[model samples]
Target chain A: QQPVQSPQAVILREGEDAVINCSSSKALYSVHWYRQKHGEAPVFLMILLKGGEQKGHDKISASFNEKKQQSSLYLTASQLSYSGTYFCGSRKTGANSKLTFGKGITLSVRP
Target chain B: EAGVVQSPRYKIIEKKQPVAFWCNPISGHNTLYWYLQNLGQGPELLIRYENEEAVDDSQLPKDRFSAERLKGVDSTLKIQPAELGDSAVYLCASSATGELFFGEGSRLTVL
Candidate 1:
């Protein structure tokens, strides 16, 4: 099943913080985060595996809870370049390389 | 290392026409994926290939869509008799472990 994302959209000022959440009805093996600007590809941010792990990259971070089948992406001190659609993906158990993604959260960062 | 490569960058065609998108995964990566993204939405998996073998294609519309990965290196996604609803961005991604590297994507505009 496809994952669900919250706060469909968010507006943030430069240097502000924002969080996007994703949840699934079924168990998940891993969660991945990606950012996509207009007219561009979705860039990989990071991936959090099962075992309730949390990961950070630069000012962006994400946490995955295998027990709850949920994940949250945190963008700390957001920058103008952070304006984009963020997607959270759940890795299927047998299909290790296949990912099921959410509807996506739109993040707009103002100057 | 270079990222996944896809072409043509964009395509505009009338309804019922045929179109195809090509991709080349990163060297030595055994996993490849094709995802369809509608405007302002997250990408949905269309197919996943593991070294020329399509392991997951349940989401692909078999009636009008087909994909192939030859030599486990390059892949192609084709749409025959395209429909207006088919307009979207087609993203190609590759994975070595869990983190995926995406290509610029091929945008399809069905008129």
Candidate 2:
């Protein structure tokens, strides 16, 4: 099943902060975050494994709540280069590497 | 390392026509996947291959769509008698373990 994302879209200015949330009805073994620019392929940003782990990439980071079956991506001090659609993929038990992505959240970072 | 590679960044076809997209996964990657993304939506997996064997294809529309990864390195997805609904971006991804890397994707426009 596809994961659900909140705040379908958001606009931010440089040095601002934004968060994208993803929730799944089923349990998740891992959660991954990706960003896609217009007309470009989605790029892997970070992956949060089970056990309520967290990972970071420069100013972007994510946290996974395994018990809640949810994840959230945090973009701090957003930059114009961060303008893109963010997608979260979840891997459920018994399904290794079979990711179901959430409807992307478009983030527009202005100058 | 070179990421997944896809050709014909864009294609235009009419209904009932045939179209094919190609992808070359990252060197030494053992898993490859194909996904379809409609405008303003997340990607949906179409097929996945381990080595040269397809491990999951339950989501692929075999009636009109076919995919193959002959050498376990490069792959191809073909759509015969393409329908208007096939107008979307076809994404190819590869993974070494858990995190997946995507290509630039091939966008199809059907008239």
List iRMS (one decimal) for every candidate: 1.5, 1.4
For A1-111, candidate 2 gives per-residue lDDT tens digits of 999999999998899999989999998888889999998889999888889988888999899998899899999999999999999999986435588899999999988
Q: How well does candidate 1 match the true structure, expressed as C-alpha RMSD?
A: 1.4
Range of the 10 consecutive residues with the lowest summed lDDT in candidate 2 chain B: B95-104
* Candidate 2 wrongly placed segments (more than 4 Å): none
Fraction of native contacts in model 1? 0.81
> Cα miss at A53, model 2 (Å)?
1.0
Q: Which tens-of-lDDT digit does each residue in B28-111 have in candidate 1? A: 999999999988778889999989899999999999999999899999999998999999999999988887889999999999
Question: For residues A1-111, could you state the per-residue lDDT of candidate 1 as single tens digits?
Answer: 889999999998999999899999988888888888888888889888888989999998888878788899989999999999998888768447568888899899999
- Listed per candidate, the RMSD to the true structure in angstroms reads 1.4, 1.2
Q: Per-model C-alpha lDDT, please?
A: 0.90, 0.92
Question: For each candidate, what is chain B's TM-score?
Answer: 0.98, 0.98
